[model samples]
Target: MKRSGPLLTLVAGLLFALFLLALNATTGTRGASSYGEESPAAPAAPASASPPATRTAPPPSQSPSPSTGPVPDAGYAGRTDDDSASVAVSLRDGRAIAYFCDGRNKESWLKGDVKADGTMKLTGRDGAELTGTLTAGERIRGTVDVGGARHGFTADKAVKPSGLYRATATVRGAKLVGGWIVLPSGRQVGILARDGKPSAAPAIDPSTGVVTVDGRRLTARPVAP
Candidate 1:
């Protein structure tokens, strides 16, 4: 067989190309190779970047309601009056309500304690727990659920142990009724007597006969007006 130089060269080139392809398969590596075919680098895997850390923010907190403005003290006692010509709590649900009355008649007056920290619970004769809070500026305010409805009230100035008073005396056909009161830091004493007999020491106010070291007073009245 006679060999053509050009034909022989063509055959040599094909063999070289096949050999390179085989070599690439054997290498199995990424990046550029001796064939200069660019290899594609296995698509680079996209580098993954981690989504920029997500940056998720937290939810905001809730704000309190704007009911009775701001309470300065949050531990104030209050006093109020009712339409029944009697004294009632001048505070409720942050306003005012009927205070403890004298036998529900609304006559005379009555007093009770509204404690701080919302623990002093008041119950009606029907035995319903009263709900309230003592707040600033010397006021007690909160809500009361009566008849399954909410009612509001608040007190301003409070009474320091205020109530009725009586005197140690007796008159024919006279009431001769009296009472007394002592403040948180004040002190006074009572002396009982019968038929002008000194059964006990008479309570005497150094200054005003009505006002003693206790700052409370006594009075006598007509039995029938």
Candidate 2:
């Protein structure tokens, strides 16, 4: 009985030690090394980075002003003649910015690019601006700043309204005729294009085979009769 008692006590001591080791393992696993019971915390999401300079808003690019190079558009083919006037075009936002003209020669007209809001701008020949805008029907009223003085100029493209005339008047109705008709070139176009009146404007020149309305020669449209 005494021996059995010592053996049982030894067994009891061993079981107690084993129980303490198990408790310590479980506690550590929960706080630090507890693989089964603890979960790793998630890292915070990084902040959204701004776009690169190339992809982000960039500085506006400067477009070089147009020059007197070969005209790039067919719309200008017959706009002016060598002895006539020159016209220039400027573009601010792709549409006609401004138009400049000098009637004495073909080298005079100039144009610039227009802004999105119809504001026109350009680089001037003398490094200064000569700009204008049309306000009324055909009236172009604008200014060019010379040095520091503002010079205002007003002009209009002439248009002819019809006068009194009928289709039956072969030659005798000047007062009954409408206004004169001219061509785009120096040559005249249709004789009866005016108010169907017989015109005293000018006779068709047999030498040049060209017609005229009033005194100015026509140039664009073909003349009838």
Candidate 3:
């Protein structure tokens, strides 16, 4: 019986040791799984930084805007398209005066204001009118109307000694009024009116602007608007 009890105790101790080993194996597996779940994965490398984008400039324009401005104060002179008349214009302080003459029997005087856009409108006696615009070439392009006749004219900018002139005198108890247009070529065309009668005028020195009419001396001065 003693031998049987010792054998039974040995069997029980062996079973208990086997149970402890099985329990330790289960706990080790569970701890290993928990540690793997808690660990974090490394962050993926940041996407390589992209280079700054390049920008291109636009091309320049081929055509440019037109020139524009106000009319300058000066004198302009030219002939009619038909070569039948001479026209003279003077501008001052935004005001304008014009004269149209055929140097023989027909003459008209006009006056008006110059616009900021370089346009002009002038009227005279006997249904006479003139309209013109300043152009890029520093010329006045316009049409003149006199005695029911319309004529186109282009007048260029006039420098010194190439402009309008006027003379007034009395000869033989008659009032004599003269107007002259001295051109850039030093040639001049004028008309003399005696008591409202028109006639071709005598030549005058452009430098001195003086003329002798019927033994009387008269000074021809520059005309202004």
Candidate 4:
């Protein structure tokens, strides 16, 4: 009886040890699986997106325009062959104003339009007319018609001392008109008229604008047309 009892106790101790080992093995496997599930590897980082491209504009261009306007005209003066008739002309912006006279009674104020080609046809009182061409270097060649008489003439450009001058006064109950032209080269020519009749003119001072015609002292003045 004592021997059977010790054998039964020994068997019981062995069975208990085997059960503890099996339980420990199962616990270790479960712990390992839980750790793997809780700490999964971090997902790969997403690639960074690129910035949008920028664009630029261009500049404008520059250019020139053309011109449009009429050409200007110039001045001129001269006398006839016999020194009996004189002429002076002033031109501006294709327009012309002229004076024709013989120191005595015959005189005319003329006006007209000049062409781009320098051609001109001017008319004045008493059916007087002048047709001319303004040549290069400020020269004028023309034909003048007065009272049905035609005369050819050539005149040069008038400058400073060679410009047009005029004088006027009442003498002996008559109106007297006079004109003097002092050439740039110091040459002088003049004409005087009383009541529309041609007569001789007196000596003139170009610088002072003084004149004496028919015993009348008159102050002449420079005229720009």
Candidate 5:
């Protein structure tokens, strides 16, 4: 009976130890499963990173337009208030070249600076002066004074066939000068000078810039400034 009691006690102790080992294994498995779940949460960090890329997309929309400027670089032509003369102006790099003529014995080639505020004043030979404001990129309104005669004018933007031209040559010991302005509607006006004496000018070929005055052949070149 004593031996049997001790054996039973030993068996009870062995069973208790086995039960404790099983419980430890169960706890270890649960801890490993919890670590795996937390590792998957690390991928959620990349999902949060995606919003910064979206934030960078709005800057291009705030950029300025390519066409916006203080002045336009083109040609402008218009008639004077009296309808007896015409004017054309071309601008580039803040400088301007202009032509004024009556198509008969009255003309001037004016050159000057274009101010930041779209104002300009140009002077030429024979006491001619032009003062104007660039009302817009495509329009100008001003007055021109030639030999004490003042006239108001308005000019519109010129394109293609409507631009400025010039020709210069010494013919028979005389300094001959010619200036032409072609309107956008293909109408033309110009002036001719001989030894500083003005006269009615002639028509010019837009494609070749060729014209003849007083039987002299002259090549008129496009003037951008």
Candidate 6:
């Protein structure tokens, strides 16, 4: 009976040890599964988005324009359309003077102002009238009235020697008023009027503007209005 009791106790201890081993194996399996299911390391934070690109503008310009106006002083001389008369016009300090002559009995002296637009209207003795415009080419293009006649003409710009001249004096008992139109060709078309009677004028020293009328020396000066 004693031997039987000791054997039975040994059998019981072996059974208990087998049960503990089984429980430890189950716990190890559960721990491995938990580790595999852990959420994937949180996705790396997305890089911050970049700011939208911006634009800039440019600057402005600063400059001036040009000028357009009339000339201050000028002179012009030419002949009538019919070539029957010679005309001379002079401009000085905004004033204008014109002379018309056929170098015979027809003659007139006119005077007026040169307007801002380069136009002129002049009146003279015996109903004589002159109207003209100064062109961009510096030429005087217009019409003249003399002895009740209207004539068209274009006078070119005249330099120093090719201009108008006048001489006034009393010769031997008669009043002499002479006017000369010295042309660009050095030709002179003039008349010496004695007491209102017109006649051919003597030749003049153009450089000196000196003329001897009926043996009396006189200075024919440049005349302007």
Per-prediction TM-score to the true structure, in the order listed: 0.27, 0.24, 0.70, 0.59, 0.65, 0.68
TM-score for candidate 1, please give it.
0.27
lDDT ranking from best to worst? 3, 6, 5, 4, 1, 2
For model 2, residues 49-163, the per-residue Cα lDDT tens digits are 9987775688999986534332221111112223232232322224442222332211112346543332344444544454544332233345544334444544333222111
Instruction: Give the C-alpha miss distance for residue 210 in model 3, angstroms.
Output: 0.3
Clashes of each: 27, 35, 0, 5, 0, 0
lDDT of each: 0.37, 0.37, 0.89, 0.76, 0.85, 0.86
Candidate 3 per-residue lDDT over residues 1-225, each given as its tens digit? 989999999999999999999999999999999998896988999999989999888897688555566678899899999989889999988899988988898888899998877888999998899999877537899999999999999888898889898999888999999988876677787899999999998988888888999888898988888
RMSD in angstroms, candidate 6? 12.0
lDDT of 4: 0.76
Whichever of 1 and 5 has more lDDT, that candidate is 5
Q: How well does candidate 4 score on lDDT at residue 35?
A: 88
Top TM-score hit: 3
- Tens-place lDDT digits, model 5, residues 31-136: 9999887744334344444444444455556665444357767789989988888899999999998988887788888999998778899999978999998865
- Model 6 residue 73 distance off true place after TM-score fit, in angstroms: 2.4
Off by over 4 Å in 1: 1-99, 102-104, 107-116, 124-129, 143-151, 159-225
Model 5 regions more than 4 Å off? 1-68, 214-216
lDDT of 4 by residue, 83-176 (tens): 6687777787778877777756567777888877778999999898988987654787898887677778777887766767788899889998
Model 3: runs farther than 4 Å from truth?
Answer: 1-67
Residue 162, candidate 4: alpha-carbon lDDT: 75
Colliding residue pairs in candidate 6: none
